[model samples]
Target: MMIGPTNLSLTLEQLTGTDAGSVDEAPTNMVRDLIGAWKTPLDQLTGREIGLLISQQDGYPYVLDLVWPMLEDDPLLEAEFYPGDILSSLMRADDTTWRDRPNYKRRLKALYERALRRPDDETEALRESLEP
Candidate 1:
């Protein structure tokens, strides 16, 4: 599917290598280009783009990793979702989607734990949301 207002044809499957059996350069480059495009002051990604990036399909883990570093950057200020809301949503994506890639799945979990421990503006509400 198309991402936000961009003319690029980024689909959920391409967001992660998913069934590619090995890492190819195109998807990574596509993601990189998307991020690069979004980072421009006039071209920030919308909440829907973020949602699509961290979507429940193949987009979750791999795209999550790619975008994780952007969370603390200026891009966060331009997005529609709160930092807490985005982090919590990323943490809650269906973990089972990548059951075959145990290590990758673990990495996503680690990101959540790291977020919780980092004491950022996001994790406080995320921690409260996950409370039992």
Candidate 2:
């Protein structure tokens, strides 16, 4: 499932369907590929699809770079009905996942601060998790 750098963009873009209904439950291997790919058209994906992606993640830099921003803008992503607990997945990040990335905590703290700017309960919850 680990696609080469050359195919990464085209795969993610193609996987990020232009039109959407329910999230695609088949072709789930794309989720594994996304774990290493630097960019994904997350904007075109649903809360459910993104949740699947996040669920499979290991707290890589992509969490800070790609996932959190999408959650910030989309109120729907905060809903509890997605395939996984996005908030918990984010909170569960440990040193093993980001040990070499010393900046992760600082960036996460900043994200928490930004989350406070939003009035929604989920974002507030997200803000709380980002710190711990």
Candidate 3:
């Protein structure tokens, strides 16, 4: 079922044998690569777990959290896999399932807040648009 962000992080760490310090210490590109490589986990997981993973991975307060944003944003980045499509794919099943999770929404709000705090030229516009 749908794991909360806390549970999802715990589970993924358990499954992958990765720790917070290690995940944090790894080079940004390496983390991006790991996220990029885990596309299979995103698809194979249940909807809830998938949502959890998405929330946990992209919901962080650091730019490091945004990484590639989705598998399609990797070398395979293509117009065919529009941003929404890539986000949908990461959430598994659909955006409906992702939005239904209160935990995901909470994390998303936190992420939005984080994003607003240290925006660059590119994200400044996104931040303004995202804020109320």
Best by lDDT: 1
Put down candidate 1 lDDT per residue, 1-132, tens digits, no spaces: 222222224543344323333233436764654444333222244555665455424343444444555654422222344545555555565756445445545566655665666556645556775677
1-132 in candidate 3: lDDT tens per residue?
A: 453233323233354455434434557854643454343333244433333444444433211132234321231222232222223333333345344254454444444444435427524444333345
Off by over 4 Å in 2: 1-45, 58-64, 71-88, 99-101, 120-132
TM-score on alpha carbons, each prediction: 0.43, 0.42, 0.28
lDDT of 1 at 123: 51
**Candidate 2 local Cα displacement, residue 116, angstroms:** 3.4
Q: Which stretches of candidate 1 lie over 4 Å from their true place?
A: 1-47, 52-62, 65-79, 120-122
Better of 2 and 3 by lDDT: 2
- Candidate 2: 10-residue stretch with minimal lDDT: 1-10
Model 3, TM vs. native: 0.28
Looking at candidate 3, the ten consecutive residues that score lowest on lDDT are: 75-84
TM-score of model 1 (CA atoms): 0.43
| Alpha-carbon lDDT, every model | 0.47, 0.46, 0.37
